[model samples]
Target chain A: MSSFSTAKPLKKKFTERLKKDFKNHWQMYLLALPVIAYFFIFNYAPMFGIVMAFEKFQIKKGIFGSRFVGFENFHRFFISPFFWRLLRNTLLISIYGLLFSFPLPIIFALCLNEVRNRKFKKVVQTVSYLPYFISVVVVVSILFDFGKANGLITNIATFFGWDGGAVISSAKWFRTLYIGSNLWQHLGYNSIIFISALAAVDPTLYEAARIDGANRWQQTLHVTLPGIASTIIVLLILRLGQIMGVGYEKIILMYGPSTYETGDVIASYVYRTGILDADYSYSTAVNLFNSLVNMVVLFTANFISRKVNETSIW
Target chain B: MMKRSAGEKVFAVFNTIFLLLLCVVFFLPVWHVAMGSISDPLKVAASSGLYLKPLGKPTLGGYRLIMQNSTILRAYGNTLIYVVSSTLFGLVLTILAAYVMSTRGLLFGKTFALFVVFTMIFNGGLVPTFLVVNKLGLIDTRWALIIPGAVSAYNIIIMRTSFSEIPGEMLDAARIDGADEFKILTSIILPVSKAIIAVIVLFYAVQHWNAWFNAAIYLQKSRNLYPLQLTLREIVLQATENSIIADADGQDVMIFRPLIKYATIMISIIPMMIVYPFVQKYFVTGVMIGSVKG
Candidate 1:
């Protein structure tokens, strides 16, 4: 049997690999069957519907039977005044998030890690997490009060002699309010993972750094930061992948027609013109564009991560 | 090797004060909501600043007003039903699926694992999902809320990973004792998997609790079945419209707005926050379980 199979390289390799997979791990296959079937049915199979982006999709004709329209759907969206604005807003918000909001949590976790008072640390951690559980609707409602012209935030701004009226509604302040609230909502939640990663660092590394006469700052820079470096890179890469995928519901809840120029993003636009207006074909086209950009960003990020740090999702 | 210096002590104290202040700011809205719910409605509407204390002699009026609305009560009922049913259904199916996927002896485990993970990375976006849900004839029904979102992809992955951490010897012994896969899963696999199960339940419950968008989109006509979030959202819409109307001063001040808004915020969040501290240890661990490796 070996001699016969060795004469045919492709067949030999296929059968050999297949035999190894089955003989020793047949129980694993049984365990994996339903989940495998689920992803196929639910996730991968839906990729076929991306074709509807090129089609004049109709419920009666279905995704396959619908007539293809070339790039008409994309053309409709790109020429519309909202396209450039949405793209600009999405990238700008994501960039702001990457620059400011992302680091606060890391710094917070580091600070929390350094606190010697365990009881005080626990209390701080508990309070930090409370804001994360508050619903987006509730968060926006509070932002409304803060951003209003006569709101307490406005009142505070007035005390400082800075204009704070209608911060949420104005084109100028929408990004700040959005990103600021985002930081508040996620800072505690985001720090938890970093803290866990911090826990995994070998205490010996800290000891070794200490023997070098390192101060807390020096030790953090030389040891603690480097120890959790991979976790940070992986997280940063994941965040980069989501540049186009900002949380849409919050935007939808907060922004109406008056605020769309500054606050409207890819997801909200899709939700509005696509889902709300029942413009499935055009919406699907726009969404397909979003998915494509997300894929590119994710792959580029993964590639950079693999090259720089040798850590990647793949 | 030196200890934290006096300069560092001052910085630490400042940092502590800053974080505490931020925490207070973070929690003020929640506090306002709780206070507004119990405070005199007129007093709450008229007041400004942080609302640090109960404004006056507490009244049951706001709760009374919210409760008097039968739709709110019905929506609450639907939400509770959805939360309980979905958590139970999701937990059972997830455990079964996780057990199946975690078997080292299973022939197709990695392929299946890859399949589950693929869904997490890439999705059909919303259109195809909506189409599938619609095709299932679940539109505008209570079942739309429960059945369509029965299994969370992330939760399933976590459960599968959790189940894999269980020892191989236990399962081998169960099989040798003539206990079938189903029996082994229930009696042996599940007993050791309590923490993961609790975490997934928390996740699914939160998802169900905050699920206004699905109910908003699906049950557009059925006000009777609208969840509290959607009802609260409708108030947001109404609040916008109401602000357009003039008061006796001929000024649109968004009157009586902050009261129920704060009250709704309290209603939606306070329950979850109260429940959180209890399951917090497991929750902290589970949240990392979702993000770190994910």
Candidate 2:
């Protein structure tokens, strides 16, 4: 009874302080209202709808009134023939993308750094970012026009012994087209960060290396690489975190039934089933699974990066 | 200047040549499309290589035909409306969020910031988001394009970083003269934030200008509301030439179909090409600002 009497005054004091704070900064709270409401309606509300994943969803019944089905939706996905194919396609496309699209930018930046003519370098850099600004729909359109049976890219491929009828619709060529287009689109834009990082490297380090009789090649290896190493590592860690997030927009634009074998990924599959086919419960369950896996991968990458290099996004 | 060895001289020549060739490769596709758009349509359809020049007498026939298509014109107008409205809407919300987040000693500021940043890492995926939008009756409306994606947390964070860099003394000086939070934000913060604001505006404008997926899914029944990029998709990807060239009779349709695709692409991209060069430096500045916190 004595403890309860003491707790009442403490609780009252806390509320009094909170009320005082609110009075002092009521304008700030007012400024935050729309932003908070926007997130609540768009982001948080959808998160709440993730509950539909466990339900046998019906459009008429809606999310709350839907019957509970436990893990049956998940079971259906796992047992489906598409499960393994989707997983493989997603990993392969991401891994291939990482392998080519990652290092090429760094190399391009390094090469640009060596150019003596500032005007030439500026022009090249400007032109390089142009493709990045092009829409995916147009980029895919370019692919279609250039990858047709008698088109420019196809003719070039035939000279190199490609027996495929058309590059765009071929399952074997889907990953290549996707990753290559990404490289074309992003190589210059992605290198912007590295270019800035290179600029920040101390000029005195290069002077010292030259004073020590180091050649340009030797200087780059000894001085420049070490300067940008942290930026590289941080970007690599960020990249690893998004390894499962090959977006569906470009894939949907590029792929057809013919290329789904090599092109169908988790997000694209979710989009097809959920939006196109209206398989709400099953699609949501599959997507929930994908999200969980992505979160796990991101956390694991961040943890390992922190332990190893003392650098993490958080 | 340092004396160059033979190998160094060779490398210099090779590097310059390589970068020049790379520039050519980068510019070729757009050049190809532009050249193809004006080329004789019959000659283009029969050809099978990269277009070095417009073949068989260059003409503006493609442009004339495309201009006659009401769908393309209406779509262009729709895209402009979306870009301007969304950019203005997004910028105001971003400034508000950035101001609140950058405020020092505000209670729950960190909590509010974390709430925004958490959205960047995890989202509820497509179905739930679609369901929410559907439930709101935004399925076939203009609000579907503008409202749901109006505020990006990434933009908020970038703008917040830029805001936090402003001298707190200026804000404090305004407060001492009986200025409220809104007064300080408008009179002090925003005027000094023109560069970052330009960057954010460009980001939002370009995003809305190029967007089609939302329209593709949301505006299924409302073809009249379709943006330029979505119409471009139907013409280029689905090869639905009939939708755009509905007025053209038989022979004219066959001749102008391929040309119309090229012209539409050129039309959609011209605004970006013209505007980007002027704003390019601002984009670089934005990237630099984003990297400062990242």
Candidate 3:
């Protein structure tokens, strides 16, 4: 450290500058009060409550009064028969969703962007967004009704030389149906951001490519792909962050005992164990596990994107 | 253009055909529900591919049954109340927070901003959130649904971006003219940010209207207090199928499954389709705020 006699002038100058800045901006603190309070109360405050997950949380005794349970809640959940099956099913469903729903909106947007018939494009966009507005309960009920072995879809499948026999009940078809329905629901609405990203590409680049004798497909691959590459990467990373958080509402309503063999996911298991069974501590442990895995995936994804593609959600 | 030989033409034709077919597949469930709802139970059961052009006179019986269900009316009322109250309250808070964050040199504004972003990455999970809500006496009440979800981090981000784009000189001029912060917010800030505000309201409205998960968790009172979605869900799942079966009088009514599903879907989606177009312009204007802020 510099001697006080030598450093005194510099220290005084720094303090004086900081003081002036604070005095000039005092009103800013007043304006920031409500927002700071909101996040503190609603968000940061809840963080302390995460401790309950690790305890024998008793509502009557309170978190402070509850006994220190160590890892018992987690151990209980992991030892349950449903643990591995729920995880496998969750992974499979998410994989199917990734395969189906992920590419759909991007492809749809690309196709729609390419369409010369604007009316047809508009109609497609409208119908696609329409399904997103329909509640998951409605979507599931409708699916269930149409899923009965002799229901409309099943009967029609018979004419097409296929068995739609109890599709919802069959463990094999659960992921396909769920993923297929999801693709239908979100394809158009999710395409909006991709389309916007595509819009930002300079038309002059395309014109230059055309002048260079690049064909439609060639131009698309060379120009359009690079232009939307960052958008795709960022969105992909975001999607990875949500990998474990499957569509809980629709899954619960559509799935039953018959379909549980293939259809049960971590979220649904947590719901049944945590909410319906009222095993709060166990569900919290399982949910916390899912979140930890999700956080890892999110950061790894963000890091990899940053390294390989220079695109990240962070 | 890819200079197409005959093979390329065939491929292009195949691609278009495939897309069209996929579109039909996507639309089939909707058609199935609509057709099934109107056809007589006997006829619907006896046929396959129950088309929109009915084989016989389309019956209004299913709709009449829904209309007769008193719970549906009550739920509809509850949904409207929740939607209006939540949208107004959530929007007000989001705008205020966004405005405050947008203000120049807000002391520790950047740190305060990071706190908002912090929520996106972490949470206490459901049990703790439920405990917090319960501790606050919000559980079992409408306040649980509204207040807990009031400040969407996404909404605040976009609204903040919109507010920040307002020139500082304009706000200073308003201040010099003796306009308070609230007055400036209403007269100047809000007027300029109307487009983004509309998008957030639309997003929040749809979200609140579609939400029943929170209600399922929180509300312990009368089923009569159920929102339209929750009530209609119970009726559709618990009643319509079984009630129809019980009344079938040995007649096969299973075929009516797809029919009534369509009617329910059509009715449920009608509100959104009707309301959405009226606000299309504003929604399209600046929804890109979140992704592409300069």
Candidate 4:
């Protein structure tokens, strides 16, 4: 009885403190209430719905009433012919994108940093970012026009001894078109980070390099590169984290049946089977697998980056 | 100043010329579209190469036709509605979240921050999110576009970083003058944070302006509710031009189809191209602010 009395007083004191805090910050909580509710309904609720991956997931039966199938959906997906194709396409597109898109921005920034004329540099930078603001739908439309048979790009290719027709619909050209367009659209916008990082590089470092008889090329190699090395490393780590997250929006807009051989990715596959085909349980399983892979890759990248360079996103 | 070596001079000249060429390459696609949009429709259809200029006699017939198309007009209106409402809604929620986060020594502040940041790393995939939206009866409704994507955790973090930079003394001064959190936020915090506000507004506005996937998935049954980009997708990508080319005869359809495609592309992108140069610096500022550890 004595122990119970002491515990009751302590609990009462904790409640009193919470009440006082609430009273003081009721308005703040009131402001946060809607934001909290928004995330709950949209984000957290769906996380709970991930359970659908394990169930039959009939629309009529609903998530809870659906029959549980344990890893059957995953097993089916693993054995499906599309398993290897989707995996290969996703990895190849991401790797090719990383190869071309990633370093180009840093190189673009470095080149821009070397310009002596400010107005010309600003104009080039501004014009370059224009495509980044253009809608992906429009970008694809432009691609369709340019990649059609007898179109400008096709004509150019023909002049260079190429006879392939309709580049947009060609499976062989899918990754090239996708990655090339991505480079055109994002090169400037992505380089903005490195550009700012370059701006932050100390001028005295360049001066010191010059004093040490280092020319502009040597200065760029020694002072300029190392100055933005951390930014580059950090951005690289972040980019590595998103290796599995090549977005479905552009892919869906760009891909047709003819090019799906090379164009279809995991996210687009999920959209096709889940939303369009209504294969809810199976698609959810595939998506869950993708998300798990993404998280694992992100953590592994962050871990390796931290170990090697002492720079991590977290 | 020291005289430049021959090698350095050559490098500088080459660098300038290369950047100039890049500018030309970047600007040419838009130029092609614009030129094609104004060209004679039949000429545009027959032509297969880049339109350096209007192929034949320049005409405003394509623009006139596009203006008369009810579907394009309605979709444009819908896009305007989506962009305005989504931006306003997102800005309010972001400001509220950012203000709360920037508050020093607030109870459960760290927990609240982590709650927001956790969504960035992990999210419910497409199927589950769609199911949730469906369960809420938001499918085929405007709310699906506005509500589901209203508060990006990224924008909140950016705004929070900007808000945290505001001098705390100003806030404390207002507090001492019997101002509440809301009042301080409006009177002191907001008045001084216009640059960040412009940045966030631009970010949200452009996002909504360019967005079509949410509309595609949500407004599948409601063609009337389709935004410009979705309509653009149907016409340009899906090649479903019946809605836009309804009254035209067979011959005119062939002629005007390519023109209409180019014209529509130009119309949709013109607003962005026009607004971008003015707001370019703000976006650059936003990027720099985002780069700061938050």
Among the numbered candidates, top lDDT falls to 2
Model 3, docking class: acceptable
Which candidate has the highest DockQ of all?
Answer: 4
- Each candidate's DockQ score against the native complex? 0.45, 0.77, 0.43, 0.78
Question: What are the per-residue Cα lDDT tens digits for candidate 3 across B116-224?
Answer: 7878788777766767777889877778777777778888888888888889999999888877778888899898887788889988998898888888888877565
Candidate topping TM-score = 2
Q: What lDDT, from 0 to 1, does candidate 2 have?
A: 0.90
TM-scores of chain A in all candidate models = 0.87, 0.94, 0.88, 0.95
**Candidate 2 interface RMS:** 1.0
lDDT of 4 by residue, A1-314 (tens): 45876998888887987788788788888888878887888888888888989998998899889999999999999999999999999999999999999999998998899888899889999998999999999998999999999888878878988777888888988999999999999999999999999999999898888889998889899999999999998888888888988899999999999999999999999999999998999999999999899889888998998998898888
Compose the digit string of candidate 3's lDDT tens values, residues A1-314: 78879698988987887788677665555655776676676676677777767888778988789888888988887898988998899888897798788888888777767765667766666666667777888777776666668755566666787664767677777887798778777776778888888889998899899889777778789999898998888888888988887857888878888889999999888788777877777778888889899999989999988998787675
Flag regions of model 2 displaced more than 4 Å: A1-16, B248-252
Fnat, model by model in order, equals 0.43, 0.66, 0.38, 0.77
lDDT of 4 by residue, B127-177 (tens): 999988898899888888887887889889999999998888988888888
Candidates in descending lDDT order: 2, 4, 1, 3
Candidate 4: which stretches are off by over 4 Å? Answer: A1-17, B247-255
The digit string of per-residue lDDT tens for model 2 on A1-314 reads 55987999988988988898798789998999999999988999989888999999998899889999999999999999999999999999999999999999999999999998899889999998888788888888988889989888888888999998888889998999899988998898899999999999999999999999999999889999999988998888889877888898999999999999999999899999999999999999999998888788888988998999897877
lDDT per prediction? Answer: 0.77, 0.90, 0.75, 0.89
Q: Can you write out model 2's per-residue Cα lDDT over B130-192, one digit (the tens) per residue?
A: 999999999999989988888999899899999999999998998989999999999999999
**Candidate number with the higher lDDT (2 or 4):** 2
Q: In model 4, what is the error at residue B110, expressed in angstroms?
A: 0.8
TM-score to native of every candidate shown: 0.91, 0.97, 0.89, 0.96
